[model samples]
Target: MSPALTAEIAQRFAAIALGHVRREYPNKPGHVLAGPEDARTPRELHPIFYGSFDWHSCVHGYWMLAHLLQRFPQIEAAPAIRALFDAQLTPDNVEGECAYLAAPEARGFERPYGWGWLLKLSAELSLHTHHAWFDTLQPLADALVARFEDFLPIATYPVRVGTHFNTAFALRLAADYAEATGNGALFSLLCETALRWYGTDENCPAWGEPSGDDFLSSALVEAECMRRLMPQDDFLGWFDRFLPQIEAGQPETLFSPARVSDRSDGKIAHLDGLNLSRAWCWRALGKAIPEDDPRRSMMVAAAEAHLAAALPHVAGDYMGEHWLASFATLALEA
Candidate 1:
């Protein structure tokens, strides 16, 4: 990564952390005081349509903050980041338990967002160099893990086709936490389940018939999950079928028993960059494509274009989207 890019990301991280504490933290009238500062305020409570805690934003915040702290250790030499963390960490909010506080009377809704990401955040923060943060967050990480199994059956409700991406993300998180803590049993079980659910077969795609957005996310998610579990002959064979289409820029439809038109769902290219997804495929298949292969350059070009487009999104130290940091980090490495 160039020094300029690193510095740019560092500043973007600092800015978003500030935004989380400021614009994203205020509550409205007549709500119980869950905490002084939270993603869900009274006026701006999360819609139960997606469940509560709105934890994904918190996860994104922690991700951004951690990357910033790791790359620019001197930032923590100042006090604001720690202040933001402290403000977010309250007695009821610590670790994964924050999700529990979402009682019905208190207007709490159950979703994987709150606890899952916070657990991951606590685990990440436990390792931070800041002694005060390490002391506080390490125990939180351990506690969250201890309670993780209790929160099992994360998705009790029925899942729609597009929602597969969220489940896939959670499974990936499980794989990451398992890898971090050496708990293979849970990770393996989740991996196997995801593989079975999403894995392609002679009869159907792993997750069943999918439209454009569903196809994009399901493929991306399955490809990533397979990366963690390692390649199977079947997955490799199925992926090869799609590679040509993505390369051709007229990629055919996602998995379905009946092959559909390229313009399925109006030929919507639902997503932008496919670098992480493509990278996962490369890692899983354990076969490096030739540099001259159109797909390889296509992936690289997509990433570079994304980075260039993303740079302008930065404003006064804040990047507009959190995922851009991860993408930037990946692209710079590439």
Candidate 2:
């Protein structure tokens, strides 16, 4: 079996996220300044998610910590995790985040990537029934939900990149939030938007995969998005058409792990996340296929191969360390 998320692993991931989620310096802001007055610090703009190098990474870093805390409440870092949430995931902080989003100049700030992670974080928080973090964070999540509601209809074309702009990755992450909150309208919109964008895609060559700065598999992530939004049998048919030669691994790039040349260089380090995210998509797709299908085992093997290549490097360098644990958590949990 592929490596599962054990208490030991959860503890380690929680510690890594906690180490930098609140570390303010060495930051990269995605904000668009409209004027000199808008040129504020990351913390000044994003009261809660101004750490872990960038906003989106910091958002998912919080998601990883919240998920780990829920999965292994007895872990050593549980107290710290809870304390962090209690202090930061408050109404006042959430209001500050919403205020940032309300800015006219910040309309496209983080776009679908940060928007998705923020919702994912909200979804995970909702699973913690005993805590009020979800309620505290709901306003910000609602703001992003409105963004998706407004954006999807006019987004005539999908961004199939392997980087943050990928629409498939955003839809996949946001679906969790839609279902968790029982927002039927958002759920239906996500499903319909995914179909409209990717339904007719077939024989995805994946030739442009593993682009220099890519952290996602454009092909597999779209497949995973369809899997999440479609019914199982319908998704099986779609999957067959999408990647017909999965059993043979015709698109070898999807099966193979990306090689990272330099962990210190942030862009190159994204290859590690690419491997981990590929593992995530592979594992989910593997489980979706019937046990009798030959592709199931192949997908599982591919997932294991990718995980092995990337798991050991999740924390060695600060470039990868600040965010890779979240992707590793996604793969392990998937």
Candidate 3:
């Protein structure tokens, strides 16, 4: 994306995260108003995560900060990032976040989407084994893990949309966490579920992509998730079947990035995320394919195309600003 991530970019991303991770105003709690007693401010509802527009955005905002901090600890923003984590990631705050999630009306609150992000944040922290952040966040992470175990068996069909509900998106993010933490049970479950839901999908209809508010590419995300779980040889075979026409660029929808006409419109801003996420998937799928495969070059080209389209818009409007850097990070890292 930038040849490499620099300290300047790290500082910028960190500053964006720090600006909203604690700015408790102009928020949305996603809380159900059951009664007068149930009414509470966002800070009261989610003590550790009351900023960044919504819960999941805030979760990934932290992920972005932690990710940058891990990669560029020499940046000026590193100290502030560490200090924020030290003050906010305490056991009591996490417990409050967990308690809010455990409420009866919160059953479908963040569901698989936010569940995946929380685990991802935990996984990133897991990389910093010497840091206390992982220990401080373990309880909250464990709570989300339990939710995943309880929910996956009942989610009969995979969500194939290109938005937050996309099953592959959640599984893809959570897989990194599972592998990093050596959660064999979770990893196996993810593999099994991926095979069961998407093992036979072929000749994907990529034309119906970039639905007005879509963020993830359903077809590409599924391919990316399968690539992670399957053996290299087996995955190459499966990918060939999944998008057999890629060599000729038949799924033109994927080769060309979506256009975002309005960064300020929240729903329209999703196109920016769609482009970044597609780039991420294309890069992952590209890297995993065999060196001599012609499709590998095509995939890499498409990934760069998509990255070129969206990387510069990561910090424009509040809607895109709140979360696009994480998507950009995912694409760049992939």
Provide the lDDT at 114 for model 3.
94
| TM-score per model over all chains | 0.61, 0.99, 0.97
Specify the highest-lDDT model's number.
2
Model 3, which residues run further than 4 Å from truth?
none
| C-alpha lDDT score of every prediction, in listed order | 0.44, 0.93, 0.88
**lDDT of each residue in 49-132, candidate 1, tens digit only:** 111113344455665576566667676323676676665554434433334343444332323333445455544564576645
Give model 3's TM-score versus the native structure.
0.97
What is the C-alpha lDDT profile of model 3 across 228-315, one tens digit per residue? 8888888988988999999999788989899999999999999999999999998888888778989889989898889989988989
Candidate 2 ranges beyond 4 A from true positions:
none
Give the C-alpha lDDT of model 1.
Answer: 0.44
Backbone clashes under 3 angstroms, per model: 3, 0, 0
Candidates sorted by TM-score, descending order?
A: 2, 3, 1
lDDT-best of 1 and 2: 2
Q: Residue by residue across 280-305, what tens digits does model 2's lDDT show?
A: 99999999988999999899999999
